[model samples]
Target chain A: MKTLYVQGNTWLHRLSPGLKLGGLAVFSLLLFATRSPVVLAAAVFLAGAIHASMRFGVVRTWQQLRVILLSISILTVFTLLLNGPADALAVFLRLVALAVLAATITATTSTAEFIDTITAGARPLERIGLVKAADLGLAIGLVVRFVPEVLARYEAIRDAHRARGLKQRPLTLAVPLIIQTLRHADEIAAAIDARGIRGQNNRKLGEGS
Target chain B: MATRDLVLAALFAAIIVALGLVPPIMLGFIPVPITAQSLGVMLAGVILGAKRGGLAVLLVLVLVAIGLPVLSGGRGGLATFVLPTAGYLVGWFFAAVAIGYCSERFVGRSQSALVQVTGFFMAAMIGGVVILHGLGILWLAYGTGTGLSTAFLGDLAFIPGDILKAAIAALAGRAVMVGYPLLPQRA
Candidate 1:
């Protein structure tokens, strides 16, 4: 899995994973509620401070944000053309602040801690029979881990196709990826079954009896 | 249904939510902003399969419904669905189902990366892009009082990004199967 979480020791890092996640959620809500540029600016400043505090390599953070920033710039120009300067600037700043804050959160928190927090938080929802929060947490962790791995595989396949001078046909790319994923799913299922990790409902029934 | 499977679904849902945290870019010509949420949706289907995949998507949608502001560009609310993008929001359920169904039914434990990729694309197109965009365009047409041609033109910008999302979904789906091999079994 391509882990986006960066390891670090900072105030933001020291904060409980649940707290940080909650803080992000709350702060983001505030931004949406007000839509005021001043509040948004304040939020952005706070986010930047936290991001800077992480002190992970400044260059790395910048690199990660380069694409995002570029997109924002393009968007600003386009929006300005259509909606005029004021609205464009407001949206642009809001987006930049939001992205920075989110990345800051990602940079400071470890994937494991984040997953734990989410699972712990979501556990209550199990009462509604919607899903077992713990199960959702584990699923989130696996998906997070899986993202980068999948991206890397995609690059390799694309490169192979390029090397073979095959046109970038969707079929050429799509079919193999699907087949490979199914195989992986099968293996994973078998592995889980072998370990006796049965359904949660079943486990609960066994426990209750 | 298995513990492992449920865990995987939650994890994928988280990934989808995380991707949503990324900011979106607004196009001048269209009201719909470009976002990473669709990529997350694509991943959900490809990784989680149809049934569980849809469930995973529901997990994220539930978060949004509860006012977590988990959508792309930090936009979230019950009312958010009333906007033009509402159709796409509703389409996610179907997209996840389509993506999962195709992967499990066609790809079927073969482990061929190519086949998985193909399945991912098919699922995403049938579920995520085509179905999603189809609904979105209709909504846009009706909501904005524009013709189908105009609505489609507005939606055209998303096609490239949606395709890219499909590719990423395929790659991520295959990698999980290979690396973890402990993902939950199909229900």
Candidate 2:
């Protein structure tokens, strides 16, 4: 299972996670506000520079983005077929550039740093009875960690199905996958309990402690 | 404090965020862009239950709102919500809640794969698909100045894919229940 993060010691990697997160937020807003290909292209170039400076190989980035690139290609072709060449090009480039910039942020930042930043930023919301920031942070972390595992499990199950010569039946693959997933969830719940990790109350108690 | 649980939560959230990096595939016949985001939503609900599920989604949304671009097609920010897809984005919250509620209610504490799978499917379909599409289609109609019937037509393309996603969510949710039985339970 390939990790999404790129290991590097560049300026991007050196920046505080909070600052980088803040910057990314600001930039995303800018992207949403502007539909201009020129500005989008410029943002992409800057993102590329950051990635390059971190010594994350462009080829590796492309490899990670292969699915996205393929999707964009298909979408571009479809748009061209339905609409026109100019509109297709504009939408495709805008979408691709946005994706690349987002990926760069993920590749550069550590999961821990991102969570911390979010927790810190969410402090204000904690007062309104929306959620406890720490708990929210913890939950965020779990989703991040487990998504890949679920994907990997799906692949493993698919491979097992192939080995069993049940290649064409989707139900055969799906049933076992669901069954296995439940089993995994049960164990995880047990482990959490055994470790004595309480929910929101625990966080509050910890704060008191 | 169990550092492990904390670690696990962080890891799962990252997976959700990373999955968002996958671009949206435009279905030629449908207005909805096919993306892996619903998978993330389903996983969050299954793994974290209602409260944590909602939290996990909010985390990703925060990243997107702050400009991290953790959304399908790498789109992010407040402006993304204003787009035609904004309704779907907002619907993720209720979807998680729906999934979490059904999983806990139907599956109980047994963690039986059958029950878990059934519960998850129910939740995903009700929350992620039915309710989500309901909100999304309405928003699409309102935003584009199209009639409800036209909006329904545009939304039809998503039904097949959304059903497939519901199936996947069922399987994935069950797996999580089995593998990580220590997941926080409602009192």
Candidate 3:
């Protein structure tokens, strides 16, 4: 997985993950509420200014944004045909502002920090017994770890196919990948059970009751 | 959820992201691509059943919300939420729910093999195609201002690919049925 986090100790880095995430949400809301091209354009400028503040340099900033830029361009072009230039501009400006602002924060914030913030945010629900905040953290952690494992497994499966002289199609790739992972899932659940990681929640619930 | 179920959900979420590494075929008319990830969504539902399946999709969305580029084409962040494809992306959750629920209700330990395959196939179509496309088209038409008929026509491009995915999910569900029986046994 490509990480957006860059090495920096800027003020954006100093801010809490909650603040950054909250601002991102509110910032999106602001973009959604406005129709004026002026406001939209300014939002774009604001996003640009934030990126410039990073001093990631033009190359680095462009590197981060080029893919997003392509899709945004596609949408803008399509909208131009369907809805005319005005809506097209609106579409482009809004996506740029949102994507840039989002990319900036993500670059500054590490995945650990992001997951921690989400876990903290879900604390209230934990208190009400709707969920275990710790399990939320655990689940996110497991997913973050599992993505790479799945990829590695995919590579191994491809290798196995190569050695066996089998043609690799999408279905062939997927079937083995899924079955192997599901088998691992059984072991993983057993491992978790052995370690008592998830059981902590149930034990706590029983104590509370 | 049980430990096995949570781990299973997380595992499926990982599979969804991995499937995304397969390059999506972008349609000339529509903004969204023909992604392999949706096939992962169908598999999650068919294999994991409803509760765990929906949880898997939700976990991915949470990853998306924090701006991880887990979507096909390395696109993530709030930018994706505003994309014309956002409708389908969000629709993934409901699609998984619909498929998983139908899988649970339709297939059983004692069911005939034909019933098992047919049931899983029907679930995938209802969830992966009907439910997902219904929401996806509506959002494209209204949210993106593309209008209904044009958007509907443009979305027709996805049908052939999506049907193939539904079939694959059904067959895989059948293949793995005996090994992993997630369907409830009635308490």
Tens-place lDDT per residue, model 2, A181-207, is 434543564565556655655544433
Q: What DockQ number belongs to candidate 2?
A: 0.17
In order of lDDT, best first, we have 3, 1, 2
Q: Which residue runs of candidate 3 sit more than 4 Å off their true CA positions?
A: A199-209, B22-35, B179-187
Q: Fill in the DockQ of model 3.
A: 0.44
> What tens-digit string does per-residue lDDT give for candidate 1 at B89-134?
8889888888888777766565577886677677777777888888
TM-score of chain B of 1: 0.85
Please give the distance, in angstroms, between residue A171's alpha carbon in candidate 2 and its true position after superposition: 6.0
Model 2 clash number: 58
Report how far off residue A150 is in candidate 3 (Å): 2.3
TM-score against truth, every candidate: 0.59, 0.59, 0.88
Best by lDDT: 3
Model 1 Cα shift for residue B159 (angstroms): 4.3
Give the per-residue lDDT of model 2 (tens digit) for B85-105. Answer: 567888787787777776667
